[model samples]
Target: MGLIVLRPTRATCVSLACFVVTILCLVSNGPCRAQLSSTFYDKKCSTALGTIQTAVRTAVSSERRMAASLMRVHFHDCFVQGCDASVLLDDTSSSPGEKSAFQNLGSLRGFEVIDSVKSKVEDVCPGVVSCADLLAVVARDASVAVGGPTWTVKLGRRDSMSASQSLAESNLPRATDDLDDLISLFRSKGLNSKEMVALSGSHTIGQAQCITFRPRIYNETNIDDGFASTRRRRCSFTDGDSNLAPLDLVTPNSFDSNYFKNLIQKKGLLTTDQALFNGGSTDDFVTEYSEDRSAFYRDFALAMIKMGDIDPLTGSSGQAQLSSTFYDKTCPRALSTIRADVRRAISREHRMAASLMRLHFHDCFVQGCDASVLLDDTSSSPGEKSAFQNLGSLRGFEVIDSVKSRVQEVCPGVVSCADILAVAARDASVAVGGPTWTVKLGRRDSTSASQSLAESNLPGATDDLNDLISLFRSKGLNSKEMVALSGSHTIGQAQCVTFRQRIYNETNIDAGFARTRKRRCPFNNGDSNLAALDLVTPNSFDNNYFKNLIQKKGLLTTDQVLFNGGSTDGFVTEYSKDRSAFYRDFALAMIKMGDIDPLTGSSGQIRRNCRVAN
Candidate 1:
């Protein structure tokens, strides 16, 4: 009944023996794990952890499996190269990536969610947040999302410049691994048998593919007969190899000790899982965890923190900036220069406020907040500025260029054009009587732009309410956020052609409002004519946009559809009555929208000119 060591390599066996000796020495004396601090980012980015938690909670709420997926991402990253974000690297022609390795390709998920978290962190602190640190925080949050223990994740880890497929293939544990091999793998990384048992409890929430456990279910004698039969119903020999079965059938989505309990019952899904309980040295540890959820939670948290501490770059050792004061102390006048230029532009033209806000949205939505929207058309590449949705729709390019010029004069190459856009959009909202929030600094700019991408991403005025919802939902914005962000129409205008069909052909339009619009927008002739989106308070930022929707006076077809017996009607009605609620939610939605994927760290460069790459 005792578990035996499978075919382990000579190197792995020697490494495990060394780790065991090290652990024994540490146990006789005391443990020594350091170099990462929990408060590492407290001053530099106070809201960093909270922001990542919110995103993780939101994503997990939408899909419970996202918790397991995100956890896998952290595990994969740590196993490959000491939690340095090597797994996130994409495969290039010259270098192979870890994402396609044997252990990662079909199993790992949540890269987009990580990218989303990275963007939010960047918006507040910009280049200050490291993708590696972001991954650790996200992993902790994902655990909490699944009703697991919350841990203080030490930060300041930096991203690796390259990934290793070979490392991932060799390091990541397989489902078919034996107990000794699994223990050796964890021990080699400085974790004990108890910690390995607790970490394995994470499988309580996730699922395993049929192919991974088909051998165990059909061929193994250690498995429970009933459990194996139940799994066999869904899995076949040749077909259904890709079918999925929960690791903890008792509560598939809850992060608890149920996985250990299942192993105690001989119902574990994978060979590696059951091997822990097969009269091995780790068997008592597994039994302790199965009987006490608190012990499991505590051990898991410590193990995760230990895993995060492996080979960390630590304070100022890597590309990680320990402080967000980089530009504040280095440039001194960088932010003030951009702010002054933004305020001056908004003072001269009120419409530029809305234009600036739209510019940020356009820039973020296409290729992250890299200021790619500011690039003009060139003979080599027709930039996003002239795309279908941006040709005449987007504005504030001159304002961006002017601000970049002033910032360059004050501190050349210090303030990035991307940061200027993010700051200018925030300043513009405040200039027009909107709620003000602090914008995080340190973003860089992109060298290239995409016209085809812009046309595909930017929503059109003629799009229906469903289209609007789908567009925003694709960017991880829920229905409520979409409604709140659409309120930005209060200070903007729409062209006649954009809404001419609504005025002439749509029945949902208010008769009086349609008649009023038709005066200047007659059928097909005045396609170029303009009309204020929020007629009641065209020059102000308020709840009038939602109120107009309630009255069927919305300028575009997309606007009217929000209130015309649709999913968004309730939000429109709610915003119409409570101005404070509208403002609060609108501000929050803007922050979320501004957090689209962004180029951070050394991925992109700060451009000298807003209109062209440096």
Candidate 2:
């Protein structure tokens, strides 16, 4: 049967509202395990939104539809003031079109879901986290939160005090994209075509305004006559005059590859969809992604994982906010129980070590599925400095002091410091795009901190892929994983300062790509040195980095290598062509990477902070 494109009205929004209710109803969990996926989609913020939309779509009367439409909001307001759910307000003074515009921005609506997740976590662990940081975590978690898929989302993102209406308009790609234009837009954000395609797959869910596709629906003068005629009936030519409809009704809220199929038969109603098939690198990507939704889904996930590794906070980053929910801040009554658990964990010893290792795997895998492990450092932002120094004075030991203090008050040293640190790291990394790396079990905690070790071992922002690869190979990591790990550039941001060399100097770059960047770079003398890694899709998980490199738009010299015809060149092309292959390989590589140099089985003591191996 031909597909039905649903144009949400006063009443249809109600059904959409039910989407949230149904999703929330499905989520339930126990203490030990998390049914995080169930409540992910049906969140209050989304439901309330769905209710308004449903009413608008289903309204049988004009007055009713107008009243419901009055309730519609925009991305500008929702994200303007911390995504606090105030964007839904409808005032008589406001223009009806303005209200509709806000409600129509479903692609930018994920922040609301993140806000809800933070609220739940805040309820359990108050003042322990900032909504900004949770927004980053929940962005990744929302995917997992809805049982969609997992990828690392780095922790420590600060919420922007303002949303740039101009920038969002300039940066956010349209539903209509041709490969060239899409590539250009991602490039503006410092992302490549590969990540562009991967990120575009985000159309797997979320709703779009019919106006966005008016050109494709009615004016595709070059398309098949029958296809164009049918689309026009559903979408009018009036610019900015539109209706709300999901990209994929089959799996309206699930992250998948149906969007790709829509493109295959020229069903692509967006300029963006038709752009991929305009016959370029994106065409290959579309072909591959279309053949296997699993591949698209998986690679979409792995690319997300690799992209998460981009410009991440590590060892001593103190700029971002750290969530305190992962800490053991129990009262006196709970201390005893905590200590008992600690003691039991300590007694199992090997089992505890293994358990720590198991949990570490989830952090980075949630984004790009890469396992880039680091010592548990409690500090916010990025640096070689450890964030857990206060732990020592807070208790008697550094890493375990906080845990011990709380545990002592409640269960009294029952929980091992190592176990606590392991759990905290997983939570923190997942908050960003970090993955759980394999740790050698049973490492004893060091009473002292190691500044020298962190500097020597941790990867830096300035390091090229070779420098990073060398560091990994020294630790026995394979080349494939090394290249795969670089994909982390998809999520985090890098200071342009880190890429000035490749952008301006020919010392370490391909002549053509470097020169172009040098000319386009407005601040090579200053800002160039400050360009960051994950500029493109910094909040998304995708393989667009690979696409960016092909365009000479890559910001870092190290970033360009994956596609610069090197040994790992195959990885670049392969990843671009097959999202599934990238997904599986990246997953394996991440788990393996996490395994490197781990403090397993009494080799080293587990420190409470991940930054310090001591």
Candidate 3:
């Protein structure tokens, strides 16, 4: 019932999801954080978190603004070097520190607070906890110190050995960044547009120096006149650059969604903040969050979890590791073993190819292809299997199970379930008449799953073109790629309940086609009845889905909306005529989809069983 934001799974760092944007920041070279347990120190150092919490609470008690300052320090530290307390380092005789970096100079504070927490923690358990992990906990507690949502901070991350000033200069988003640049910055770290917009809501409780917003208030065209004039009183172009202004004009000390509401009224404090609502892809979500504070809070918590998960040195001593290769020295036959099993499964049941491909989308869209969708329900807690969007609609779990079994025989515990699903999806596409592209391997499986996330993130059959676009756009997929990916409908079938409304009530449907569909899918109820998504060449992987849409024969309303006189109509028309264009774009789009935030290196575990954790 809530707004479901599609969090893209991380792909192998070969290339980013190529979006047509103003700027593209290449993904940082490092393994991302995963497999972190909230109770990581429950046994080793039980009082570790509580000790830090007490210290943080004491610091914030003296100054309410310290909460916001501490939060910013964590964000800046993570953005530069995986939140290893690198930003807390001071300039020494040997090397320059990140504190002197252009983005952090005279901006970052609250280092003494972290030092105090670390001193107390070291006395209780010396070197048992890492600075990187402690910072994550402090960030969560700081949010709750104000009025923001709370989340469990995953532990066991190690501190970085080195820091990069240049990386901070390139990676950290500027206050004057446009929407595209802001999106690229976060996407490079495996977060999405909705997360970017939600995370920006943190500006609600922070203050910005006049130097950060002077240009926007003085020169930007989209700003509200009265709002800009009021801001200029505290900040002047010639002299008051160091003077401070609240990032959110209304209730600047609160942690609500008022920042988004300010954006709607053209009162956003920074250019990057206003850029979210200025006729861009992130506009609708901004409007949604402005009206619904709970939605904003929910998404903000998710974003913090995601941001905290960026490129932690997991299971290692704070070092960047090489990515997984199909033909690795240790796992020589990994790729071949997966390829053989997937071929056998698809050869046995041809329909399983389409089913497997759809399964990959379902897995990746929810929580980054960690095989969480393949999980069956247990007594402890539910999985994604019973979600409204998944329930009985998703198929091909058996094929992935079979592949994992065979893969285990060849290389026990060497291949991860996350990697298996990626390889299977690629091989499944090849089994059908689809294009062949390289599949990036070496993704680890997640220990937990979320049914609520599955329900919110998955696309619905009744979604309009705008909703469809927004859904894909949340994962950095543009309209062209979305239209091309919808070509998957060319090979699948839908239930009668899914398309019954289109046949009976929709005016754009073809007359004869509607009449034919009405026989099986009636006016009243035949919800479980089945209908092929593409009538012409139903099992073929081609442009027929678009061709059918051109004739108003798309089985679901979401599918037909592609050719229903919208911005995406031209893409549908082009693909319907040119098969090669569709194939090329589809392959690229699949690679991009596969690249959604993945669990790489030692971040996640290699589950022996696809359905349950090892």
lDDT scores in order: 0.74, 0.41, 0.75
Could you give candidate 3's per-residue lDDT for residues 258-353 as a string of tens digits?
Answer: 888899999988898889999999999999999999999899888888887765545432112224465487678877887888888877877777
Give per-model TM-scores.
0.52, 0.36, 0.62
Error of 3 at 120 (Å): 16
Rate residue 103 of model 1 by lDDT. Answer: 72
C-alpha-based local distance difference test score of model 3: 0.75
Model 1 earns a TM-score of 0.52
- Report the C-alpha lDDT of model 2 over 1-614, residue by residue, as the tens digit: 00001111111111123111100000011000112222332332334323322323232132221211221122222222222222232223322311233323543333233334444554444433323333333334345433455554433222211122322233334455345545543442234666667766766655557767676667665455665676566566764455665665456555667777767766665677667765667878888887877677677676554443322211211111112232345332432343444444434431232223333332222111111123344454332234221111111123234444555454442333444444433333233343434322121223222333334444444554555544444333556776665665554444445566566663545576565455546553544232334445554435666666666567766777666666777787777666556556665665444432222122223333434433
Ranking by TM-score: 3, 1, 2
RMSD for all candidates, in order, please: 19.7, 19.4, 9.9
Alpha-carbon runs more than 4 Å astray in model 3: 1-314, 317-349, 408-413, 465-470, 473-478, 563-570, 602-608
Candidate 1, run of 10 with poorest lDDT: 21-30
Best by TM-score: 3
